[model samples]
Target chain A: MAGEASSGTFLQGLERGLAVIRAFSAQAPSLTLSEVARDVGLTPATARRILLTLEQLGYVRTDGRQFSLTPRVLALGWAYLSSLDLGELAGPYMEELSAATRESCSIATLDLPDIVYVARVPTSRIMTVALGVGARLPAYPTSMGRVLLAGLSSSELDVYLANMQTEQLTPRTVTSASLLRAAVDQARADGYALVDQELELGLRSLAAPIYNSRGRVVAALNVSAHASRSTPESLCEEVLPHVLCAADHITTALKHRGHL
Target chain B: MAGEASSGTFLQGLERGLAVIRAFSAQAPSLTLSEVARDVGLTPATARRILLTLEQLGYVRTDGRQFSLTPRVLALGWAYLSSLDLGELAGPYMEELSAATRESCSIATLDLPDIVYVARVPTSRIMTVALGVGARLPAYPTSMGRVLLAGLSSSELDVYLANMQTEQLTPRTVTSASLLRAAVDQARADGYALVDQELELGLRSLAAPIYNSRGRVVAALNVSAHASRSTPESLCEEVLPHVLCAADHITTALKHRGHL
Candidate 1:
């Protein structure tokens, strides 16, 4: 897109190559040359060349006709994780909390209308959709998302709400902008958030803000469980204290390490 | 490097762009334009364009002059992790083993002479260097590395041995090729590998091979602890059984999913 605006400086080939890599997702883990070309808007011959180059670099592998990303591609994401040091700083606390709660604990940072999980420690499989590090969830329906959304400035939150596609992911999902805004305001006042069966049936999560050394809310930490396992009142009474404490511990650790 | 040989088919700009991203590391998390250009072996003008493109794509962030990757880059690795499904399949078992043994547990796959961690559940920080998913360690001195290396065919092992740079990471590290070969042979015969203070002075680890449905060794799972906390006999008697059991559970799960 930048290439269209400034063709002289931008490297469109680089953009196209990354798009090719991204075209392979959970829905389509592997694809043929033509599929890749069509998915990324490249010619078949160009896609073949890029695939060949990626294969040569060990980022991709080919089973003659189909191409898929290799484990080596994980290094691309590793570069960012290692630099962020989020896992290293927050992992032990999340692990302890998950162990204590017998549920999934995760850390996520705001990425506009979506919150992307950066680190997760799972105790059991609770949701139909498998959630892991880097999974994105809408800010309006999830506890972590709401806490992160609550951290944003009013104007930033307004802009996010203006462009947000408020779909009803589940019957409990808040589709009204005003209701969502009130939820976010409540999260800010409470210093934590609780979402019960909003993202999916039988799922509930509680989240608390994680602050950096500068006292800025940089991420949100959550504990998630099945609604059958945890009622909203129980989540607040049992899980909220642990989640808040773990979030505070991580914040303190980050501050001690001068990561803020 | 492949671009140098096959310039016609390779998108050198893509290669350069990735190199630029990889230029940021734990030691240098943030870089100026000139620093990035110098590290990636590109001109300032070219590096600026790539950085601008990445920034626009939300993969990189800039603070006036300095640039660093954003958490969105984790999605690139998530694509591979979610597709591989290794973490999802292996995580709960790793957590159980870690909890039972009170030691760190990890799963790693061989990548030439290095072993890349695919999944990890750590109980406590024992090593000087942080080891997480996607962290790479030389195969010669680590227990997981040895287990993975032992899984290779004789010819493949020979090729790896020939290319390996056998550095003396610690006083306990085996530097002789024949000695390392004997260690690999022992691992093959024992069905597990144990290394004490080899990779790091205070670290002890034991690893077992995890096989796919086809009975091919696909990965190695290990339990690690401080040498002060675990002796060789303790590792053999206490840690080995849990590590082997966890690996078997993961292998069986993989088989059930028909992933092998």
Candidate 2:
């Protein structure tokens, strides 16, 4: 895969404009012109120009002093999701799994050190951190992340490990590179991964890899529950079967639809 | 509200870059360099530069010959969705409505002549067209669209009517401008709208307006089903109450969360 943009062909203005868009977050929904400037490390005038361009494109809306993204911004993400077609293909199966397990179920893909949820079927709110589609969590500590990481080639895994921070999110989170590597290896060998409160206290999850027609793991499916409600053994025995079945169902559907 | 971008302040480069991004769709996931240029009305050189820039920013990925958006592109949409916080607040209620009605339920906001779905819960596949978050459908032919249009101010409604293209989506679709206005007025008077097979053959839906804490209609909630499965009277009697209740629930939740 091509790694870097050759400087002769890159557009720096486009990058800066996207950076300005990325500067807004849930915590900072509306930002002043100077706030956007500071967040993206650009001048107020430059930020204003980019924001104005976004506004013109119908992506951003300003309420006099503060600027916030409009619903039109969702179209950008929708293009990606609709192209993937994961939600349409896997949604029914996920709903069934969520109902069967009475726990939250999600499908995610690895984005380096983080796993981004592409589709989710929530049964109950169990996580301290709210989980939804497009929500990201650390890869090493999440069951879905570990399953995705296990799908990577050895060289790719090495590169990921080299840059991985392995921060201690919870006391049970494995921080050591060797141990995390072993866990990923185990996930590959066992065809599933089960993490007990690694990402947060009282949260346990089990995940399995979802393969495409090319026999490549394109995504990971998981069933997450409270630790008090599900022991690791119970999760492995009960939820694991349901999650693996749902993953296979999604894989088959994707392959049949030529989406794989 | 700031309606338009000031002419002299906008960055044309940013607008062109986003146009390049928007050019990709579900029907065309990957495009060659020349194809991207032709699709976006840009020169091959400019398209290559923008693609290279997007590649550097990790939003676009290349498979040697073809270029497709990477999962990172979801981040742009996620920023908006997370900021809106609509999916988290309204999700469970939508699910409940879908379960109670055994149909697909969604919440959408008016984007002028189109309605953009913000949150959805699907119980079954009822329409030939797949409906998901960010999916836009013409407002005049959809239940949610009528409710949202009815919520608009008279001036805004006039602006919409002036520019509206009333296409014949289905035989039942109201194409007459005056008739469409009557439908909008009826929606405003009844506090709900029931559309019968206007968007597609054998599809019916009912929608109700959702208010923010400020008592402004912020969104519309709807339940859709097959025409054979649900008649207009059945939809109004059985599904309308659940939809309206869900709308009220969402509005109350948004109010308590200070999202209004």
Candidate 3:
């Protein structure tokens, strides 16, 4: 899209159909026909056609008025997750990190304004929101997101910040683009990002990047805990080293597997 | 498809596009242009259009000759997994079962001739084949498959059997349709299924059905182990009780969550 010619070959029907699927998020799992249309910015008739197509394909299920997705949808993702091998590759290191820190460890990559968790190892601390695989968090406020942001090229980072919609999730959340840019720069310089009580009131986490064989940052690994579990200084002193080591181990594993 | 009238407004483009996405699987993660066209039963020109659209949309990536799926495809599955809430609901139960048996615990539902793993709590035993979430296995030989197949109505099960292409994965795998039917009935009668060295030479597992509040069996939960760890007799004598209890707990949780 940035440089290539997409007009002659682009498939609008495919795009619209996928957009309709995207309209349903964790916050709004099920949506009425009109809601889907509105969310995807399509007409009612167009939305209905796409929804009906998806329903016919067993990807979407409708119960009279509202429509939701089915487990069959996972078949679409199985190809990607299995091929990427991130979850299987990162699982052991994450579990060890979780055990050592007595907290959850997650691996995530950037997905625009949000960071999507690709894998996780939990210490059984159930939070208000269930942060499982494929869970997303705003990139501006999360340690993993900041590390991922730091991995981006300067121009790409500038473009993301320009389009980012920052929310004041906590009192410490930095909403200004200039400050967020500076934080990303600091993360790049320090080789890690420590976010304290920014994403949530009682959350403290630090993250480091996982590189591929080519030495490009492919994902971020983070150890997340309750603020009461450790102060920011103690987290840096105690957990940051483990976080960095685990991330590097994952990177080395990726290289050993010949993934660039 | 059995009874519904799908005349006009089926959106063939959407259908074909999704078919292209489904062409990639764990065994065949990447495909060339002609391979995609041949596998998907689409003309090379049409397949090229869909592939280009997916590439621009960030779901597919190609390196000159071979095209593979990207993690962005996980977004499509995220909607369904999160909405179903099974992974979150079944997580704690699966962990407990895995801990108790010192083996991997998984939950799966029927998807035609296959059972797709929806949730799993794994032990750190790296196998030749990595079994993680979204992994699919032939339904004829797995304990979970038998349990789920038993849950289907007689007519539905018959239809599935008629279409199912059973392969003798191991010497112990039952390939006869009548024998498979008998096995499913036995599972239904006993409220559990134990598959011994059927899926693989050294793998053994026993599964129990997880029912919704409406008493409809929605998923099957299983504890899978190596034959060295447990004999068929010991698995039934020592591990069957925990597997049944854990699956029942998941059903209760689903009921509490008002899934049905």
Candidate 4:
């Protein structure tokens, strides 16, 4: 169920093997052969074959009887790091923004209805939130992703709205497509987005988009904090300016590097 | 050439696919078909085939015919995040340490001769070092890894030392085995490690191991800053105590969770 079914013989073995590797993460960095089998929904025999395969390839290592991930797994993340023009160019500006506000800040891109964090600087980690690099949150609910989506073409927005499977993450989560669209429109007009206890309870965030030289938003940058620390009004009044400034700085950096 | 020769019979195709995926990063999130091929030293046709396969697998997406990574890539790192009991358990403590020192902090596990960062709370990216959640650094040179290595058994340390290929990242890098072994021994005796201008010229870091209830060091924690900001004296005097305190707090948390 995790992968698309390809017509004819299109690397089923490779797909299964890759799924096994992907099965290991910060959450499940080590597993017994059977745990991996259940996680990837493959048979135990198949999982063992894949794990053995991965071990032989040096992407994984076994300790006596227990299995653990190897540092070689990092090569996958490094590939994306080595090739992304936006993430690299945004570094100095992200640091500047983090320094300017002394708050946790991040850059994320919209992966359709979800926002995947591509970069982050954690000034603090709220006990309830797991907001780290490579973390994901629903796009319709997160400030950064919504801001990025605000720049989408109307048709693209419509597609997202149509396909969105809304689940109320918290009391503030807007499950109605119309409400979400209105929020996106407001974000476009104001050039920023604010989410107040929508994605997670007691978390508030403000975001602004980083535009390429082509004027298309390639990413979004934001500052996030506890709702107790960031009232909606104060965020809009105090933090919004800094978020917008950071976005502009990132935009300028991107343009200077011709990444637009 | 980067992999063991016998690996081809195992998950080599998946490894190559991961290599293709790893080729993209915050620095290079997107790559032309030919550029990816060139960077990975794969034939253009082979790279194209792999990219097509990755696209089908939802790992990569095309933004107007140019290949860009999707949030799905985070799934790989997420596996590590979700699997590692140590990282999740260490989160709150890391944040506290980051706040206390007002500097970046991270936890790493020794991956033989290298250390792979498992959990981190980066305060800022002032020096343009864009290390991410799954980043790798030389174990002998990084404070966290050295601290972790200091806790290793003699045989384990011998194997690690025997296999180390110390590339001089900076002029200050420790290349001699005896010097590196002495540093490890000192760390074992003092219960902390200090690294200055070794990995990055301006960076200074201090680390301490986090022991579980079993009194075994499972991970290493460190606080890093610019040399101008945290001199060797300041790091040992000011930073080491705080790092050790945070490490103890994290160990208690891990014990409470019954993960120790």
> What fraction of the true interface does each of the listed models get right, in terms of native contacts kept?
0.45, 0.55, 0.47, 0.44
For candidate 4, lDDT tens digit of each residue in A179-224?
9999999999999989898989999999999888889987899998
Candidate 2 C-alpha error for residue B55, in Å: 0.9
Model 3 DockQ (Cα-based): 0.35
> Worst ten-residue run, lDDT, model 3 chain B?
B1-10
- Over B1-260, each residue of candidate 2 has an lDDT whose tens digit, in order, gives 02222247665556667887777777877789999999888877778878887888888888777888777877888788778777778888887888899887888887776898877766743221256567888899999999999999999998898889988988899988889999999999999999999999999989999998888888899998988898898888888889889999999998998843
Model 4 interface CAPRI class: acceptable
Per residue, candidate 4 scores C-alpha lDDT tens digits across B94-207 of 878888899988888766667877777767445233465566787888998788889899998888888788878889999788899999999999989998888889988899
Predicted complex 1: CAPRI docking category = acceptable
lDDT of 1 at B64: 78
Worst 10 residues of 4 chain B by lDDT: B1-10
- TM-score for each model: 0.85, 0.88, 0.87, 0.81
Q: What would the per-residue lDDT of candidate 3 be over residues A91-201, giving only the tens digit for each residue? A: 888878888888888888877778887777767633212676677789999999999999989999999999999889999998899999999999999999999999899
In candidate 2, the residue pairs with backbone N, CA or C atoms under 3 Å apart (3 or more residues apart, or in different chains) clash, namely none
lDDT of 4 at B1: 19
lDDT, candidate 1, A95-190, per-residue tens: 789888888888888777688887777674322126656788777899989988888889998988778898888888998888989999999999
Q: Which parts of model 1 are misplaced by more than 4 Å?
A: A1-6, A92-104, A123-129, A213-215, A225-249, B1-6, B91-104, B123-129, B153-159, B185-191, B211-216, B225-260
Q: Candidate 2 chain B — worst ten consecutive residues by lDDT sum? A: B1-10
Comparing candidate 1 with candidate 2, which one achieves the higher TM-score? 2
